[model samples]
Target: PAAAADEPGTPQGPRAPLHGAAGRPAAPPAGAQPAAVTRTEIIDRAKTWVAAKVPYSMTAYWSDGYRQDCSGFVSMAWKLPANEWTGSLATVADRITKEELAPGDILLFHNASDPQEGSHVVIFGGWTDGTHTAYTAYEQTPPHTRRLDTPYAYWNNSAKYLPYRYKGVTAGKASTAGAGETVPEAAGPASHGVAGYPGRAMFGPGADNPYVTRLGRQLVRKGFGTHYTKGPGPRWGEADRRGVQAFQRAQGWRGGAADGHPGPETWRRLFS
Candidate 1:
């Protein structure tokens, strides 16, 4: 049954462990391959609940078999093999920097001491602007699942909301080309007609040139355009950095190599 009120405040006293409709514990199914999800897939799944207005319930389970609460909402979005609570959600996700946040990532606040005092989670839709002061948040609370323009992190406990990305999530398939858009095919280093590795000076902060435009176009072609709300224009912006980083990470690069700056190798791979 749905809670009498929508707020996910902690219930008083000790509580029984929550489970799925099948009476299984809130953990991934044994011996199952983790779902290789995409950002689009995660956001699409989240929107279904928002559209359906799935009600909030700690004990009740939705038809999809996930608990109808904050953590369950994220589990459903990530398409985990089973339901997960705030305490266990991190097991399947990696902590990410705020700057690395992109659509389909989550801002999680797990209150380990109380489990519910003010713990919550919200899916990061995207930054509302270049300022990075706020974002579009998709969440399930009280009344139901909702999409909101929330402040950086959240309205309350803003400092506690940390970013995370699902481990199984991929860069996703190439985006369908819009009219007049050219979709670049994945190519090897020897592929003919690939562009030369533009000098690194053409990218990074405060650098703007035709190469920036070229890079943005190629990023769009390669399906990393989710960061760009309007133009992947010649201007070097956070969108460009994020797109580059996402592409770099897609290639299994990390640390300094995936720092979001396009070096010679990154440029070659992107063009390839």
Candidate 2:
């Protein structure tokens, strides 16, 4: 699993179940198409991802064959010809202030000196509180699509979030910025961001969390498991552990390392 700005660090080892949402939110309604998507459509597309509960992939994983990273997800929402990293994407937008943020605007986190190492972007879904300390947002993160409230990594520090709006996105005028251009469907992950799963602190056996469920889905997707006849829930059971070990074995890991417990190295490979 590649590290994204949303994640804090790797889990030391498997542990007891933690309390929280499964790091995923349900998708918004597909709704009726308007012949084409509008700026509102861009935001709606992002919401749809939340409803679908698409899993995150540091290698810029694709869901329904569309790239799914913070930037890639934004690109998909903006309907760009190709996926673009946050830096390049920022080039096309006009910088704005926090007070100017609105639906469809982007919240960016980038260090101009080293954009690739620690950068993230999210779609503004509006403020959640009166003081605006927290807000609703749409983002692609490790584990899956998120409909999140603020106090998140990229949003905590006012200095971290640089607000921006696409040039074509006007406040009172209709625009085609979200209509997007067509490009060849490409393979491979985006070249920006850390290359590993950086969602939770750790994923241990018997740990029923969204991270575990995410791992289970990835394992099944990669042909490592058939343990779940129904669906992979947020639980680290024998089947989930077995799938991890299988993936390790397939990667040629030896002895204890392949014993089914995921370490940083294992996560890197799994996410990559």
Over the stretch 200-225, how does candidate 1's per-residue lDDT look in tens digits?
A: 43454334468888889999999998
After superposition, candidate 1 runs with Cα above 4 Å error: 1-33, 174-272
The clash numbers for all candidates, in the given order, read 1, 17
Q: Give each model's whole-structure lDDT.
A: 0.72, 0.57
Number of the top-ranking candidate, with TM-score as the measure: 1
lDDT of 2 by residue, 1-272 (tens): 13333464211111111112343233223331212334445665686688678766545445433455677777667655445566666765779887767667788886567655557788886654346566667888667788766553254344787888766553231221111211122211221232544322224321445777777888888888776665777755557667888888888766555656565456666777
Question: What RMSD does model 1 have?
Answer: 11.3
**Candidate 2 global lDDT:** 0.57
- TM-score (all chains, Cα) for each model: 0.59, 0.48
**Model 2 TM-score, 2 decimals:** 0.48
